[model samples]
Target: MNTPAALTLEAPAEHPFAPFVRILGKGKRGARNLTREEAREAMGMLLEDKVEDTQLGAFLMLLRHKEESAEEMAGFTEAVRERLTAPAIQVDIDWPTYAGKKRHLPWYLLAAKCLAQNGVRIFMHGGGAHTAGRLYSEQLLDALAIPLCRNWQSVNEALDTGNLAFMPLQDWAPHLQSMIDLRNTLGLRSPIHSLARILNPLGARCGLQSIFHPGYQSVHREASSLLGDNSIVIKGDGGEVEINPDTLSHLYGTTAGVGWDEEWPALSARRHVKPASLQPEHLLALWRAEVEDSYPQLALLSTMALALRGLGTPREQAFEQAQRFWDNRDTSI
Candidate 1:
């Protein structure tokens, strides 16, 4: 066998996000995390398309390999926030739905609709079907009769009448959406996935968000705390914001710039089981009282309780208030 020799590689001097890639990939001792400021600049360059496609791919994978720091995520989120062109609108909640549902119909859509009918203005944004075998929120919005806003003007109009609107990530933040689309090639999620959730583009006073991984709870909590937004992060069902009524959910977040956590006990003693089939229309039917599924009803109420808490309702009263809203929701919408 021939003896192996060490080889040195160099990042292009002129490439944007190159320095960021080096900071993450420069071998054990040489690699270091980016300062929040550096991360902001790097992400700004990314949003501006200052980095080449190859450089962008390498940067994302390198960041994924090392995992993202809360500071880095906070910085990247700041960059995305600064780039948003959404017109000023009164939004009560910033709901980011990135993780598409697979095993369950998106019961959380009913939760949001309930909240909207109760006069809460919700600004929701997300991508659709980035991964195969997943059912995304956008796929069901039409059936729910919720407007999928294509631009800031449309968003304003929808929120004006419906008190809720869903903006596709591609329409709201094309750069980050492009990165999300790379999931098929990367074979793993990049930091952009986490960053987009915290964008809170409208700078809403409260945020309702979730992550697939439990460890990411701290990343989201710390980042939101740093951003000084009253937000709640949970390990949601199928990684969507829908609460899992079958297991305890440890919620982590910051309230008025102070870090706090709350544990929500499971809603049912029966073992949580996914439905054999995920029918999007079932959501509408349930809303219309045409279908009477116990689990979906529990999921809608549980999810709304969390949203109510995030909106500053006292924890003990939130569920009751959510149920009240659910009972009185406008079926005509």
Candidate 2:
């Protein structure tokens, strides 16, 4: 059934969004669920700057508690794709957004440069790390002398020639970034953070993503399902696509014409274990020297490299390719 043409024309009165406020603001339980379509409509208002700030905050909190339904996820994805501002660019390189680990940036930083060495176009997006922990993605990038791209063209150049680009939360989607800034004012993370990961319009046709938490697993899986193929996921750290040595790396994927590989594979941690030769003191130095050597990465770098290579290339080749990239690579930024 079509939505009332009128609701499509104008913003719904506060009356329509007010109940959401009441339910979300009071932290109440058992509110009637918003239909998947209504949820999408609600997000449309938010992105079009139709919803007032108060209602906006309320709606986010409400959804956080009630949890997002699959249909709602589809609606949100549609709304964000419509709102993304990243410029369209030709895809010469075989890569998409590679979000770095915000909590610990070293491994991802290394992987970015490693992949860049191979001419695999890469772009990583994230605000910072530690949440409030004061450390962010920039510190490491600064250490390596890698700078942020202000324009999509520069990013394209980086991908075409060197294969690495870093875009922060501020670009691509300011509407969502505005909500992230509220972290300081409201002292909480809304669903906006999750939305940022799913809204990879930068290369929607070939965008890649890092799935961090168990909660986000289904969220990304279902949302990507709505998008058909064109999305890939790797378990990430703190919600970004950095590696974790403690666990196996699992790659979930789908492509435009090609469907998902039924034999979803896992890269065992044992194969990518941290070297036994390095002492604790050396380990400390390893972390510090990452910025200096451009080889700054965790043991999981090998696994991530192998996973990425498996997509269009061979796992063994990707692993060797990543190692060679890491060995000769210069953070010379």
Q: Indicate which candidate wins on TM-score.
A: 1
What is the Cα-based lDDT of residue 212 in candidate 1? Answer: 84
Task: Give candidate 1's TM-score.
Answer: 0.94
The deviation in Å at residue 186 for candidate 2 is: 3.4
226-272, model 1: which lDDT tens digit per residue?
88888999999998898988889898978876889889898898966
Instruction: Give each model a TM-score.
Output: 0.94, 0.74
Predicted candidate 2 versus true structure: per-residue lDDT over 1-333, tens digit per residue: 866565446655666667555643453555656555666777777778887787776677667776666567667777777766667755422223323332343455556665666655666666544254333556566555455776677777766666667776666666777877676666667667666666665653445556555655655666667766465566665455554554655656556523353222344434443343322233234434543422235443554464465356556676676667666755354
**Model 1 misses residue 99 by how many Å?**
0.9
**For model 2, what is the error of residue 277's alpha carbon versus the real structure, in angstroms, after optimal superposition?**
20
The positional error of residue 151 in candidate 1, measured at the CA in angstroms, is 1.0
